[model samples]
Target chain A: MRPALRPIVTLAPLAIVLLGLFGGGLLLGLLQSVGLFALTGSDAFTLSHYRALLNDREFLVSLALSVWVASLATAVSLLLGVTMATALHYGSFVGASRTRWQRTLLQVPLAMPHLSLALVVLHLLSPSGMLSRVAYALGLAPEPSAFPVLVQDAASVGILLAYVWKEAPFLAVVALTMLTRVSRDFDDAARTLGATRWQMWRRVHLPLVAPGLVSASLAVFAYVFGAYEVPLLLGRTYPAMLGVLAERRFSSVDLIDRPAALALALAMSLIAAMLVWVYLRLARQLVGERPVLF
Target chain B: MTSDSASPVILRGVSAAYGDTPVLRKVSLEIDAGELVALLGPSGCGKTTALKVIAGLLAPSEGEVYFGAENVTPLPAERRRAPMVFQKALLFPHLTVAENVAFPLDVQRIPTHQKKLRVAEALALVRLGDFGARLPRELSGGQEQRVALARAIVSAPRVMLLDEPFSALDETLRGQLRLLVREVQQRLGITTVFVTHDQREAATMSSRIALVLDGGIAQVGPARDFFTKPESLAVARFFGWQVLHGANGNWLAFRAEQARLIAPGGDAPPEGWLVLPAKHLFTTDLGTQRLARLRLAAGDEVEVEGPLPYVAPDAAVALALDPGCIREFPADAPATARGW
Candidate 1:
């Protein structure tokens, strides 16, 4: 629209890459005639391999833990993220003060990758880490092992912390960008109608930005749920995340676990699709608005 | 000055600034109980700023605001009994039209049935009955502005502040809404402050117009007098029409309707007449009386409201005006702004 974008016409050539990868994989599945390599010329379709996924304990446990972590992380981050966004957006913190510094500090976490950040958190919270060493120096602990392992703890607080630290800033950025679409006049109008600052934010700003906040939380949920590297580097030994479990199954000595591994991958994809569908359904029903009070 | 004592809303020496830049200077005015006064000025001339200060949205850097003779300068906007109608008619996007008008009642914690009845009455007063179920998106621009007006009035506030509420509407709709505003104000008799960059609209609706500049009132008087007697040259220029100058350079003003065609070297050039070759610039064929804009030899463009006569672009013409039709005063010697 601004006329300066004419040079980006070259990027249209990249459609071939999209068609090659995703389109090629879909075609491979479409061409399959349900095990043509069988000794008998069987003309039957079978979902026996997909149905076999439910009996596996590791896959099921991994699926539950991933959901547990993703839901916990998303809920906690959204609460804090939306609160911070509304405060910074509406509060009286203008013109070269400490608020600008705080905004800058919040963005640094977002600039770093999630894997690097997990390692940083692990270094600080591990038994021989900074917090433990400090406790030992203060004579609060008798020895190094006396301090309980905070990193990769059984409660998954460590994983929750890692997700919140990386994803809250992401949510905040998405929410703040969406906030500009709302009218400031609504806040002013609300105040004139006898609504206090808290009331205005609760009644007006929160409801208006709820859709954006939900979408942002969904975005964070999708990433934290399926993340492979971060969970692999900092996950527990017994109940691994679904991504790590799937990876382990793929690298097995024999290819006997292929069908089960594909089932797990398909399950994770199905959950993510449900989250997206929920967002779309909510978006469709967002037409009704509340009237002003006289 | 004595009549101001009866006013419900009063501002005394109010000054407001943003950071180091002052938006409104020491502005003080009083709105008599059940009267509507238009705070008129150009965009960014501190008109809306004054409205905000009075509404308790912004604390004055100096002076005080009084509602019912009680100092309310320290109060927050929520505590003040003034509801503002913003320029864009900022209806809550999540609320229905009925709910939008009922928002203040909801905040005040009124009963549900009462709110419904009040919202219905408010909607009907704006001639928007049964539009209560519709969203703001479903209404036209004029209708949205009316909804905003309804919301403000439904509060039954002691004072109402409207900041350029009809600016978003087209010209014809704007005039129709202006008349509607006057009719509504007369019926309700609320102490209203209407802020606008339009002088004609202000004169059309309000009982009086406060001509503001530099964050202060330049002149406050009857609506008719503002067009007749502008306090200074700056005030005169803000209004689009002319301040006519006569022989010996006395301050003079000629009414546009008094302008007429004249014969060359007529018996005696009338008082307000300045004979010159007129070139027609534009003409509109209004159903009742067609109007035309013309520029004289002195390059002064005047909008004359009368029946269109035989006149073409670049045509040589003469003007016959009466001296009695013009108002004049002695010029200020130090005022050297010329050819501006």
Candidate 2:
């Protein structure tokens, strides 16, 4: 007979804790779908609710809007992010006081909360906001109304602005992190080969960090999709994003629409899952398997 | 262009310090073109920092560096055209082996056709003609480092800095890579500075060596002279154990090879030179010569080099000392060693 094992006995508590967290999340999702031991037993699984979700146009519009806003925001943020990171990384901007202040200010945006960041955007870009106020004082505008429609305006411009304010910093941070891993040796090699700083970045640094930027942008895309509060406060009605639509569905007073709310949530979940999968798949295709581990 | 590639590259009144922490003090040397110079010392002897300054990756706190007759002291690393290979195989992992070798040319925007030809030539010179298509990960560690060398010389840089490039490899692999680097450096006539902490590495690779101690060059001379006869007491002890005597208020020093194992009970040691065995014997493997350690009664262990085949362990072997290896040091000197 085997002896009572000391190591396994000692490891029992850790094993229970690990499985409780890792396995419990998916199990809870499965149980809620099946109405197993839920607080409300009446909401049982049904095929019609799921079918109605597929047929609903409002849910579909919100889903499409999520993708549209996320992709646009991610693309614009990457362009801005790459520009800002490169300016700071290789530039002797450290010599100028204003550039130093700007560099310090760059870290501030990443630390600020998204809601706080949205407030910052609203304060600075609203028709009656800081820029408009300055314009009013300069006689550029007859009144605040003379300013262009910015807050809750069509084209999702205000919402996209707010999203980018938060997301661009995140992208810049990731870009800087990736840039740090580019070994000086490779750059030195490039220089000896007679590469200018810009040329070195184009040939060496860009290829090395491209994969990380792709993944960072994908993450920003996902973050933009799931942001419920940002669009709820800042988004337009004509092209309502998915987060705003999902919030509306969950808060509807009609009792019969509850199933449709669950269906909308599940639909949003499915789209997000697909985007994430496709993003990872395409990144792997482009970058291949081997690069610097750091 | 350098006015004369035949003249030596010189460092004048060179001193480097970081935040009042002195790293190199009044250190200077002249390295000739087509010469292989080794900066030999234990780590933190400012060997790597010196190489970096020469490569222009670092601007020395003081003094100027000259390539032949022209002063290129203030130039950026790229403008200086000094390529360096790091201890780790620091290849551009993102690029394929061929693309990696082609990187310098691509950066310079060489015509696509010429870039390919240079890459082929560089890879062929390094005996890696067929590895161009493979990524660095596909190749072994030594192969990856060889690709780095190919990239370095593809542009035909005037100076090469090797910061212990092969130090990470095993002994056998290191020897092979050493030969490869030596042959290629010779063929290209690139003035090379190799920084290594291992005495054996410094001894084997360099045409000449500069010994560094306490952030300064202690001695600089031909490798054979430095190895066989180290002048300073610190340099003497750094090589191995030696016996010292006082004559005319100066300290006279000779190697452990002068002392032999006679019958144990001793009133005093023999006239030529004497050392009593301590407690340890470290077996060292030098390429051409194998050496055994003898611990003297003074608790100092000195290495005795002879025609060694394989001696029995702990057997008392008589040493035949060559008095020519004996060196004398200044009596008032301080203690400092720059060795393995």
Tell me the alpha-carbon RMSD of every candidate: 6.0, 6.7
Q: Among all windows of ten consecutive residues in candidate 1 chain A, which has the lowest summed lDDT?
A: A30-39
Candidate 1 on B1-340: residue-level lDDT in tens?
0122233888889899987999888888988888889999877778999989988888899998988868988899998878899889999877889989998988888899888888887888899997998989999999999999889888778788889999888999999888887777777777889999888888888888998876778788887776666666656667644554555766555556666654233354555456655666766778877666767666667666666574666565565566555556566521221211
Task: Please state the interface RMSD for every predicted structure, separated by commas.
Answer: 0.7, 2.1
Question: What is the lDDT, from 0 to 100, of the residue B185 in candidate 1?
Answer: 72
Q: How would you encode candidate 2's per-residue C-alpha lDDT over B37-74 as one tens digit per residue?
A: 99988878888878878878777899889888889888
Candidate 1 per-residue C-alpha lDDT over A1-294 given as tens digits, one digit per residue, 9 for 90 to 100: 445765555554675677788777544333222332222344345565456667777777888898888888998998777777766665423443645666677799999988888898888888888888898999999977788876676767778888898888777766666675677778789989889978887778777877666666777888878878777767887698888887787677655554445556666778777966665565446523221211
The chain B TM-scores of all candidates, as shown, are 0.82, 0.83
Error of 2 at B335 (Å): 4.4
lDDT of each: 0.75, 0.74
Model 2: CA > 4 A from native? A1-68, A83-116, A128-140, A181-195, A225-228, A245-294, B1-8, B241-243, B258-323, B335-340
Model 2, position A239, has a per-residue lDDT of 63
- Candidate 2 docking quality: incorrect, acceptable, medium or high: acceptable
